[model samples]
Target: MFIELDFESDIPIYMQLVHAIIEGIATRELKPGDELPPVRTLAADLGVNMLTVNKAYQHLKQLGFIQIHRKKGAVINSDEMRQADDEFYERLLTSLRPLAMESICRRLTKNQFLTLCSKIFDEIELKGGKC
Candidate 1:
């Protein structure tokens, strides 16, 4: 599995990691029972602190995206475990609302916004962008 991190991004590294894993699941790149890299190993590879990876792992586990095991490490959760979380959607909308409103303020049309979303999703599903 490939995970990308943006060091210059405004979003926190841990949160970005969380989203990256979520996208991995959404793209079907990570199926149930697939083991993830060890937190320390991934952190070292990404040039981030172990704590950041741990935080991301903890968040993913909390959201039912992955299961943490002492002996087997972290693995993707089953599909049934990946049900939509309302709190997650609420947080996502809260984060995007400002940017969406800004686009509206810039006179972006609903069709344009929807088209953009569609195109982006297409690219994600086809080209498999991390989002």
Candidate 2:
């Protein structure tokens, strides 16, 4: 719920909103069944366009991260979340490939890269994240 947007960043506002919400869920700041602010309200609160918030919400729903209801608005999905399947694994690899390549180009050792990944996992776990 505490989203901070970097207006000057190269990232698109809608993607940043999506990432922030996903991070909130990961950190347990947004638990199952928690209702998100209405799109118009959140847009006004964040000084962003309602369409931006709507786009992010739609993406979240598509990604199975949240559910949208006409009357109830958006809420964190209460059902048990899906496990990583082949599709997810494929997407994960696609996402990580560039980062891994960049790390290699920067001369980061395999152990160092893995250590960084482990550290991130540890931090997320410490914050009560499920993944």
Candidate 3:
């Protein structure tokens, strides 16, 4: 419900909402089994269209981040977030390939790129940040 959207961003509004929720989960701001606001209520609160919120919620559901129950609405899944599968790994590579190529094209070495990634991961502190 605290998700913020930048309408001017190149990223789609729904995806931004998805990212915010994921961040919340990762940062432990949203604990397992926590309930999210109802779609209409959240849309009203965020000043976004209902469909936008619905789309974001649907995406989260597909990723196993949240489960929709008739009585509970959208509640975070109980500490069983979907693990990255082979397809997910392939997609991850597909997404990173262009970025790697771009770095090479810009005359950055492999070590430089790896170092940058290492620094980012270190800053994120993935282990400590997990929900």
Per lDDT, the best of the predicted structures is: 2
lDDT of 3 by residue, 13-52 (tens): 9999999998888777888989999999999999999999
TM-score per prediction, in order, is: 0.84, 0.94, 0.84
Residues 9-114 of candidate 1: C-alpha lDDT, one tens digit per residue = 9999999999888888767788788999999899999999999999999999987889999998999985576444788799779977997898899999988887
List where candidate 2 sits over 4 angstroms from the true fold: none
Ranking of all candidate structures by their TM-score, best first: 2, 3, 1
For model 1, give the RMSD to the true fold. Answer: 2.8
* Reference-based lDDT, residue 78, model 1: 57
Pull out the clashing pairs in model 3: none
Off by over 4 Å in 1: 85-89, 127-131
- Give Cα-based local distance difference scores for all models: 0.85, 0.93, 0.88
- Weakest 10 consecutive residues, lDDT, candidate 2? 122-131
Error of 3 at 93 (Å): 1.4
- Model 2 scores a C-alpha lDDT of 0.93
